[model samples]
Target: MTPDAAQAWLEKNFAPWVLALSPRVTGIGPGGAVLEIPVTDAVARVGGIVCGQALATLADTAMVLACAGELGEFVPVATTNLETRFLTAARGQAVRCEARVIRAGRALIFAEARLSSLPEDKPVAAASATFFRP
Candidate 1:
């Protein structure tokens, strides 16, 4: 799908909580997508740290949309497994979640995502997920 189409899907199909996190779709391609979430009081937990749960949810949501882009349209899918690892805390600035499809099969898809802060070489969190495509 075209970048515009991906952006439109991000705006339309993402969950209300995900949308409230204010993620912006920066790029979309056959196997990868980039999403940026601005740091705000609402998205952060106590002490102004970005919540790990939000990061995980963003990763999963972005990967689903990326898979949809690669398929050229939306397909109903359910998460079968999701594993998230928090490497560090995100304190300031926006965090970027980059998701890539590892593989896609007839009934399942595998994906990975990295969440990092701007100019940081290390990821704050990483996630691997499997989705049951229907």
Candidate 2:
């Protein structure tokens, strides 16, 4: 899907709380998608580091876009499982999530996402997601 359509989808389909993260679809192409979540104080916990929940949302959201790219359009899919690994802390800027659809099949899609600090591109988190067509 085009970036504009992806952004519209992100705005229309997700919950209000999810929208609060201010997800922006930077790119959507052949096998994957790129999403950026601005690091706002709202997403931070006690410390300044962006929280894991925000990263998880980024992973899940990016995977959906990646799956859409693989399918050539958007469809209803729910995340069945998400395995997240926090590699480092992200602070002071947006976090970028790059998601690739590892496998897309009749019933399920498997995706992997890497979260990194924006501009610097320092790896911050990784996630593998399982999405079931529903």
Which prediction has the highest lDDT against the true structure? Answer: 2
Instruction: Give the alpha carbon lDDT tens digit for every residue of 42-87 in model 2.
Output: 9987777999999999999999999999998888899999999999
Worst 10 residues of 1 by lDDT: 115-124
Evaluated at residue 23, the lDDT of candidate 2 is: 95
lDDT per residue, candidate 1, 27-46, as tens digits? 88888888888889888988
Residue 23, model 1: lDDT of: 80
Clash count, one per candidate: 0, 0
True-structure RMSD, every candidate: 1.5, 0.9
Scored against the true structure, residue 17 in model 1 reaches a CA lDDT of: 77
**What TM-score against the true fold does each predicted structure earn?**
0.91, 0.96
Kindly report the root-mean-square deviation of model 1 from the true structure over all alpha carbons: 1.5
